[model samples]
Target chain A: MSDQPTGVPREEYRPSPSDIAPKLADLQVGRTVVTASIPLSRADLVRYAGASGDYNHIHWNERFAREVGLENVITHGMLTMGSVISRIAEWAVDPGAIVDYRTRFTSPVVVPDAESGAPDTPTTSLEMTASVGAVDTEAGIARLDVEVTSGGTKVLGRTQVKVRLS
Target chain B: MAVNTELQGSSYPLAQPFEVTREAIAQFARATGANSRSHFDPESAAQFGYSDVVAPPTFAVIPAQRTEALYITRPDAGIDFARVVHGSEQFTYTRPIVAGDVLAATCHVDGIREAGGHAMITTRTELTTADGDEPVATVVSTIVVRGEDA
Candidate 1:
């Protein structure tokens, strides 16, 4: 099979596990459009706290958070950040392989039911809707745009992911 | 203890230069479950345009850690050591970062807001090099404090 569409001798190709011959590694970042609401729960926060050992007061104590000026014990930064990139690990040949990645914090992620005085939400992870914001398949990279919202407010906003493909 | 609500741009007092070793990056890679030979294996790293396996793309967490020093961890932060929550963090690389690279990080207070009585603080840090001041990456972190009602 030939990659040349019009017989111009194209210079792009995807990598197979056995071959590194990609002078064809000419891949460009692609976009994966997505939509999902971030679900936050007290328990999920607790679990993540245990796993990450982030005992920051801003995270779990609703009253403490309110005392200082917070809506509730908001979710952890790493938890949400981890969620932002979790998909890449799932898709990459390596779980945590990334050539480069970054994002700017635009909003705070508030877990549902924390302030509504209702029962805790069923999940801890922010239910994020990710989409391909850009792509460079020719460079073997893709950037995913992720947004997790609830009650019409963006909980995790401006979350982006960059992945190095196999 | 009262919290400082007046912090603004350039209010962050962080020493400019720092260094990262392969060991520290390897450790972070392990904690993140992305530990690969190129990241820790010096020989394997030499194959990828890196002196060492180069840290993972998300390795910015290490420098971001230093950024924590720029903010004060206080009682009024409304954070219950027992109940604090993890909010969200984002890292953007302006240039590739590698192990054994000495870096300089400059941090700024991006924004501050009040939400349901919680003090939301956004801290931004730019990682660069001493020689050319080229930006390597940026980290924007958001922390929401849930405090007791007055």
Candidate 2:
């Protein structure tokens, strides 16, 4: 099949489901899945709020967040979860491979407002790392332990996903 | 204000069926930076074996949250809207939700507790076909409402 329809550059095409199916043998427990970083900008938050319909003032209104005792406007917890799963989908080469996912918002991700002079640059970055926590070959499921941190502080805790390798 | 423990085990009625549309899927995919073709293009989605555009996994939260509001928004629910913080989210999908599908959500309060002067409420929402018994997805959300002292 042509990769043109998927828009995935031919060179960057990670294994599709079929290809991943045959390589299940390589998915061992304790193996690293992938490590990625997603920079969070106010624009990303705005777009996410619009998309997810989570218009919580703490996520958008700086003054409201401050008044509520938060240091600054924070990123939506669900947005952080979405960003983490997008990385997993990229690694699996298919979003459908993920059947279950969960996470705990242990700490708030404080996103500073855009710089006074530079309005387009991201102010913070969330680093995510995932590892194979368990594998059930017979069930075609693999459990991934994901950690999301911002500025070296844990933001999401007990994050995990169950992916279908076959 | 003390946590409303009485609401635990309360089950709300099924919400109005929500129609999953192609535009909604595309918009969510774009916002989350999920560039998968299955979430955007119907033809490309068919190649992946889905009957229609598949929504990203987190999309289930939309319907679940809507249904959850029916319980949390009650005047006597003891929830302070201004003080609530989303603590966690978990999703287990019976199958990926696709565009053109209509779904309904039924929510039940699983538990409510107070710790360190804050209220923690856990709720579960079951998403199913609009007119059938087949399950679509289950979402579990935990919300924390801070007490005045904390």
Candidate 3:
């Protein structure tokens, strides 16, 4: 369960909002290729389970999680969906411009093991691509087509967000 | 799936209030891969112009779930919980909810219909200040109960 997978490194994040161009300046419209990853741990699963009241044993209890055919403790699909929201907020040219977002849970994130805060397992690598789904400068609004994945698995629920930007 | 058209637009009240605490916010931050200092530390939150550790925008679901019970468990509404697969989740925030804001979420069955071989029910939950005077955000979530096939 603690095996490290071959792909990306631990806890990698990129492209803070300050790094992006004026999203609506010239209004570049097309697909965006982005990749990021986050470390998974028991602390996260428990916290989310409590906050969201999911209480699904597969998300926490290690033994129970294994019995259910999971590689390790499974992260709540909602939690992963929530993490996607952060990437959106971070990617937007205006950090606070996110007005709405919606999506379904198509995959479950496996909880990774760690040793005293040292990563003991492989992190969930997210390779996502976004495209201009819509643009309305007058409304300061834009929508993006999104697809997320963990490892080679495509996380279901193609996500989209409506945002207000500069 | 059979039809339940009358259930459309039926509104329900929440039995409990969502208590916002600094610990709750921190817990949510850890799980969501949010490395933002403001969500985990009160001092940082205050520096960000918040009263205390502010929860991630998606953290609203914890409190929102407290109200979802009304719609999901309505016996007369003819919903079979075992067949429900979360169809969608969406959120809109008016502002960041600090640790002190006591939230109350009320669920309204905005609409219901039989579609794509499933019963799709739309639920709109309003997370508001306890007195219901100020609005925080509205979570519009929909679920589809599969018709024997799903």
Candidate 4:
């Protein structure tokens, strides 16, 4: 398992919808809502593979990845997609608030071997930022446009999240 | 090998119901680093008006992909699993999944076409409650199979 905890403790971050209502009320189009740098290590990939039941060797075996024409072992697109959405959920103060989410796998986040570094050390970090793309006050829904990048290159494109605020 | 175009437009209904459990939800939440209490604590979820622990947004992919496998793994489907790469994914949910709900997915291979010698396959999966068949979520996935020569 990955030793690094990527998110805050549940107790410290819990907020009811009533609690987050004010924050949602202040939402403005183009306002930045969340910014995070989530780290990914090989162990994290292994853990996700187990949990998601997606054990494609390209995610865990370096040689196999190269044979498949990839630059190196890469993080699963679904893993990246899944991990980044947590930021929106945290910001909305409700995991179930999100009704729509989508992303294009524009590029791979290559995870190099950790032999030279500590086993738990991250191979790369996903730099994620989400901004209010649109706010529909009547419908009480907000559209969030998320940008996810690794190694200063966009990995996921058109990453959009729609959350119910009311 | 090129993907079997004949499989396109085919639909595969769920082979069995997937019983959602708190333990599985917690494991997936931990794995994805989603730390919301609604994913683990029933009390917190109840506070949000859910009957039980609520699954994270992307949790639908778990059961959806299982149904998708029934199509992609067929010998006639012609997908080279080792060479397949995710292209895009989208999820639209009618409701959030909660623990204790029995879910089943029906997968449709919506499209399959050759692009630049590679196979571009698209699938849409509908996930619903097993008993009442209440629609919970729909997952759309696109995967590309790299050509051997490429």
For all candidates, state DockQ relative to the true structure. 0.15, 0.53, 0.37, 0.68
Best of the candidates, DockQ: 4
Instruction: Show the colliding residue pairs in model 2.
Output: none
Across residues B1-150, which tens digit of lDDT does each residue of candidate 1 receive?
A: 223466645444346666777766665544333424555666655555565546566666666656665564544343344323335566766655777787877677776676776666677877877564677777776665555563
**C-alpha lDDT of residue A82 in model 3:** 74
TM-scores for all candidates: the values are 0.59, 0.92, 0.75, 0.94
Cα displacement (Å) at residue B107, model 3: 0.6
Off by over 4 Å in 4: A1-12, A21-24
**Candidate 3 structure quality by residue, lDDT tens digits, B53-142:** 766768878777668777677667777664555677888878767888888888988878887778888889998998899998888888
Question: Candidate 4 chain A, which ten residues in sequence have the lowest lDDT sum?
Answer: A1-10
Best by lDDT: 4
RMSD of 3: 5.2
lDDT of 2 by residue, B74-104 (tens): 8789898889999999999899999998998
* Chain A TM-score values for every predicted structure, listed in order: 0.63, 0.86, 0.69, 0.89
Q: In model 3 chain B, which range of ten residues has the least summed lDDT?
A: B29-38
lDDT of 3 at A40: 51
Model 4 has a clash total of 0
Which residue window of length 10 is worst by lDDT in model 1 chain B? B77-86
> What are the per-model numbers of colliding residue pairs?
67, 0, 0, 0
TM-score, chain A only, candidate 3, equals 0.69
